[model samples]
Target: MRIDKWLWYARVTKSRSLAQKLATGGHVRVNKDKISSASKTVKTGDVLTIALERRILVLKVVALGKRRGPYEEARLLYEDLSPPPPPKKHAEPAVAVRDAGAGRPTKRDRRKLDAWRNDT
Candidate 1:
């Protein structure tokens, strides 16, 4: 099956055109070989490395899909081998706030702010 069609059928991309772009733009690889065309053929057991929005995917093709199907059906098309993404750490709130249009701090104010910051 064509890589683009397989990607669409597997639900990796929202549209076949996007899959084409991804393939032609050098973001898709098959069996460690870079594919520069959407028409590249894929077969069962071929490993694919796909780069997407904020992550990378390593999948082994399990089947050549017959049609664009539901997520459950799509899930059967490939075996995911990518590692889980790292957890996000929530940043702590700012220790100080300044209102809009606030002018630059005076020398004394700067010293006081520095002292407060150091104390924390």
Candidate 2:
């Protein structure tokens, strides 16, 4: 099967056009060799490395699926060999407390700012 078609059927890409773009953009590799064409043939047992939006994937082809099925069925087409995703980072608290477009500081605000600065 064509590499792009296989990618779509395997649920690697949402659409065949996107798969074609990915393959032609030089983001798809087969058995460690870079493939620059969407028509590249892929057979069972071939290994694929694809760069997606948020993560990279390494998959070993298990089957050439007949149709674009549900996620469960599509998963059977390839064996995921990619490493686990990194843990999410925690959000940091904002440093600046001033609101936007608040205008210049008043006398009291200046005194508070001076006090806050001296303490810091």
Judging by lDDT against the true structure, name the best candidate: 1
RMSD versus native structure for model 1: 5.7
Clashes of each: 0, 0
RMSD of each: 5.7, 4.9
Cα lDDT tens digits for candidate 1, 1-120 = 999999999999999999999999999999999999999999999999999989999999999989999999999999999989999998876766667789888898888989999998
* Model 2 C-alpha lDDT per residue in residues 19-104, reported as the tens digit of each score: 99999999999999999999999999999999988899999999999999999999899999999999989886444367889988
Clashing pairs in 2: none
Instruction: Please give the CA lDDT of all the candidate structures.
Output: 0.95, 0.93
Model 1: residues with Cα > 4 Å off, grouped in runs = 96-120
TM-score of each: 0.76, 0.74
- What is the TM-score (0 to 1) of candidate 1? 0.76
